[model samples]
Target: MTLIKKEGPSQMDVVTATASVSDQDSTKDVSPATKDSHTSPADPTEAGLRLYDHGGMVLVPTPTSDPKDPLNLAVWHKCMIIFLVGSYSAFSVLGTSGLSAVYPSLIQAYPNESPARISDLLTYPTLFMGIGNLFSMPLCVTVGRRPVFLFSLLMLIVTGFWCAFSDSLGSHVAGRSFFSMAAGQSEALAPYIVEEVHFLHERSTKLSWFIGVQTVGTAAMFVATTYIVPSMGIKWWYLIITFVNVALLLLSYLFVVETKYERVEATDGAIVHLNFAEADDSRDSESGAVRNGLRLRPDIHGPRTWQHDLRLFHFKPVWSETFTFYKDTFKSLAIPSILWLLLLNGAFLGIYVYQASTFAQVLMSPPYLFKFAYLGWVQLVQILDCVLLVPVLGYGTDLLAKVMCRWRKGVFQPEYRLISMSIPGIAAVIGCVIYGQAAAHPTQWSWMGVVAPYHLGYFAFLGANLVSITYAIDSFPRKAGPVLLVICAGRGFISFGLSYSTVPLISKTGYDGAMNIFAIISGVLAGIAVPMYFLGTRFRLWAMQRLWPKLNQ
Candidate 1:
């Protein structure tokens, strides 16, 4: 009777008892500890990997598994990363634009200097901006991003203060050299942005915003200093900018967390998601307890004191290390995407540096009849440029990816990103022509309508350059930084040559011829995208097949 009662049941009772037995079996087969240890197999389709610490805590590792991660960025911890990576972009533009307003004052302070000599003060910083990267590229990657950024910032801050008070060309040149030393930060920024962000899908948009903000910061400094110099005097302008930079330094100290992470999966800096205290507690008895509470310390660059850090200047016989770095820096030249990057960046940078120098001279001085501050108001168009591009640039690139993904039956290709370059490329050429022609024939044209094209072209320029860089980085996934470094070096050289010579180029060619030349060159090259779109697919496939093996080896 007892057996019958125990065995007997309505169908429901039988099902319930069987389920209870199965649950017991499952519990016995997989202990809670075992269940906690295993990740529910990742979707292989996703590119990133899962990271687990000692306490059964999981983190999404950076984008790669190798000793070096692409960007090693994390989700939800980007503000600091953006700030740190972005610091260089800010420095680059500020150094260039700030001096434009102060040139006359600089001339007054250092009389007996030719306009060309004064311009050297302006030009050399950019020259160094590019040259400094020559050294920083290999060093940053070999040493680390944080150390280079810190050292650069320190050099910039100290030298900048000295520059504000200096009365001689030699001292100013020394200040500018330090300014150049810090310039590598900008070259490093793009890779940092791409590496530490969400994914290939999200990189373009983020990069666009980063570039756009940098433009605003750069443009505003020019516009601001234009007025401030007149009222506050040049020394005050320098002092004010230096003080603003001090704020930037403080921000870096406080919020800009170290990006270098231990777990290969840690993509962003200072993993905010993990509860450090709780993680420590959970793994207190574990053999790998050290890994649980792994917050990165500030001195990740080894225990080099400030004096030792400065002594890098004296660290000789470093030829072996230096040679290795230069070898890596040159790696980008071998990639075709680098050519596109070099062309696009060099063109854009040249036009911008040239225009910034000449436009004020051409417009404010003669036929346009505007004063410096009023000329500053001309930058209002830049406002429109940013207004139009900011919301769309990143998202537009992503949209291009989606459209391309569909075209390929749901497979994504690097070539798809190239399509976004066309509109901007054409816009750039047209802008150069308008800006040049209008300045040449001021009597024949209204300055307002003429200036409109230049600003409009800038919008497209930003979009296209953003497209070019993002695509190149994505396409050459393994060598993004090295590629950008080469591109930047080329751009630096271009910027240096054009900035110094633009006055001469414009004087020799006249505004009409100069603009026409740039227009034609850019227009002809703009067609590169059409072929790029058509042939780009085959090229990328061919390159990927040919290069990845070489790159890996």
Candidate 2:
């Protein structure tokens, strides 16, 4: 009667009724929830228990009777995890992108510093964030993800205060840098959280949705700060951020569960994953144990008490493993596919930041000299850009993956998701070209024409960014921790390089030449997608069989 049916195009986000999502969406007529489910003989590879629903949707990870297991947690509990993951990461985008909204006020407040010096408030923290990526994952893995997240929130709150009260530019830069270092944890840890809680079918939508939430939240902050700084002053604006961080910390404490669960591996030492597009017709049956999209767990363990969740000490606090992670981080970098995904993901991040750094500068000067406060309203473009992109990136990728797997006779590969990158990749190139031309000659184009396409360029980079990450996690589900840290650290470094080069490059080559050069770089990197589509699965399978154990060892 409602969208609560799990079989169709997976519901994008929560709408109250719990929805079931499958990588391979069922197209046949299936009985209703209360109807009895009929299943075929059990799989015998390991003396199989029933795993398929009546419509042949393979329950990811095969639902367990253990209530404490993450997969078996109440639907409401999983939803809470989803909300917290998106919310904390969304909050981090403010320190990075939203800071630019206050630049006009900052220049007036510190009349002694040049505009370029004021931009350091944005630049220095970016560099520190890359440095923070080096440690973000190891701490999550070695100490426990929950503790690391909690600690990062505390630091964000503390640093926000330091930034608000700072009397000198040097002190403010130091404060912002530390704040970004903490913010890096949220970004670096997000992928791991996505992999931990979601089923295979649900991953694409959940990941893209969270990324969208952050991007939209960032713009909303821009809109807020622009208006706030003019009326209350920049100092008061930061105080507002500090209060928000405190509230986020309180919410995180209530909801975020530690997501460091042990995953199962197959006989050849590969991770066991189910691809719904490959469903065997022989198993087109179901189990009565599954009802209303939940695995009916026995009451043997009793109801899970809050203590299993609220306890602070989940691990032994292994400080020594931090060194182990540091070593593995570099070792993981040598692997070819891992490296490609890392660079691909980082390049898009670099592109996004470059646009963020330049957009305010260009819009505030010359043919269109916009007032500082007015720039906040311009964020509507960014907000609209993300809103338009969420469905295309999230649902589009999931649907593409489902169809491609069916086309391949049910053999689903990670490369199937990369197809989502094609349109966005080209859009990025075009957007860069148009933006450079607009920036170089302001008289020819109106503000609407320039900013719309310029902000719209985000469509490509964000799509590419999410695709590269989703594919990597799919390829190496077990290596989610180490691999994510590598990508985050790489992007952090890449962002620093792009931010440092931007002003000098613009000065030497003119805005047109500087941005066109980025267009070329972006286009060239994008070319790799074709080969990745054709060759990615082979490399992933080989690594799973041959390379995975060696890197882990």
Candidate 3:
């Protein structure tokens, strides 16, 4: 069952294989039109149906005639969902780094506290954030996305207020930790949400927006807190974020809907059954309307009512699925490709955190006694790296994939995405070296000289992040949630550990020694992309044949 392009007025078409008599007999209570749609085909033994149209670039995820399927939703609806999720991710990262900008004030507020102890404000929250994924991932899989999102936002609001009002160091630590645990859902689940709603072509660009907003939010908060902390005091940071959280929470309640659906693949001439009865009836009524068109099915499932979407509880969690989540996570770690991605994502993030954690301490002392406000300006390099690099790499990689697909006669390999990583991989190494050298002799070089490497290194890091995750999703679309959860958890924990030890590590080794050591680690990890580009396809095929079968069992 192949997907051949038909020269119709519309560019898109649905190609479903005809169902068997047994299927129709089983669903006898279904409507006649639906029954006819599911009736047996002439040849019933055909396998390996085409699921995507490379010539027309259409998804073949077997979206029901139902408008409720995320793949079949209206453009406006898709954009709204994307915007809300992106905002949620941005705010999550913002909260993670909110305290970093005001460390000076935190130190003064608790005069007896050591620098490392104060840094716990950032460290503990980040650690809990990673741990949160274990619970959030399973809950999302069982209950649904909407409830998890609403609950997470509520927790953030409550915790943000707690942090704002708290005076004691212990209270602050507890509040931040709980707040991070809630916010961790955004990191673990947002990419999965993007995958649920968007198609293969749309995934990379939208994910870029999602992750780009996260980085921007982190950098922007530093800039905003610099001013807010000095005049309004450190407590105001939480108050501001709390207010923003509340507004976003309301928006989420109104706009976001459950995106979970079981999509089946059908080939040309196959009879596909519609999931929703209302959608089937509506499609049946539109006899003259062409089914094979670029337009999606109109919303026959009816209006997006608040009552329907606001359901707090849905499915019960099975303990077996929870066990599978853990088992799959550990089992995946053994795969060479998955292991490489874990290292790639974790090392870059750990190195980035190391730089961020120590940046203020190193710059605020000796030859470069940068004021708090000026310290915020130093993060502009990272902001620039994300803003400029994310779009280029995201859309560029997609374009590269399309070009390669065309060249290879419409056979798209996941390894094609890795080709774009070569430039960034080399850049990361160079950036790390320059950043290390500049830190060693701050007076010898200007501030720009010191920061240039950091920017370059991060640019490469961001690109690698986009490519690696997209590749993973492409390789294992069904297990995207667990795959991404593991990456987020691994990186988050690595970054947390590095953040915790940054002060002491630098104290012992000096700025040059710490930076160069991390640089070497990052260089080796990023350099792995070269071999991955050439051999990644073979690795993916090997895993699918050997590793996937046992894991599935």
Model 2 — TM-score against the truth? 0.83
User: What lDDT tens digits, residue by residue, belong to model 2 across residues 94-182?
Assistant: 77557677776778888988888887887777778777777678888787888888888889889888988999999998988888888
**Candidate 2 lDDT score at position 233:** 78
- Model 1, 350-423: lDDT tens digits are 77676667676666655777776766667655767766665666777777776655443334455677777776
TM-score of each: 0.74, 0.83, 0.83
Best by lDDT: 3
In terms of lDDT, model 3 sits at 0.67
Question: What local lDDT does model 2 show for residue 356?
Answer: 70
The model with the greater TM-score, 1 or 3, is: 3
Q: Per-residue CA lDDT of candidate 3, range 388-428, in tens? A: 66667878887888787666544456677878777677776
Per-prediction tally of clashes: 9, 3, 10
Position 61, candidate 1: lDDT: 24
Q: Tell me the deviation in Å of residue 447 in model 3.
A: 0.2
Candidate 1 TM-score versus the reference: 0.74
lDDT, model 3, position 28: 12
**Which of the two, 1 or 2, has more lDDT?**
2
lDDT head-to-head 1 vs 3, winner? 3
Off by over 4 Å in 1: 1-76, 83-88, 260-322, 537-553
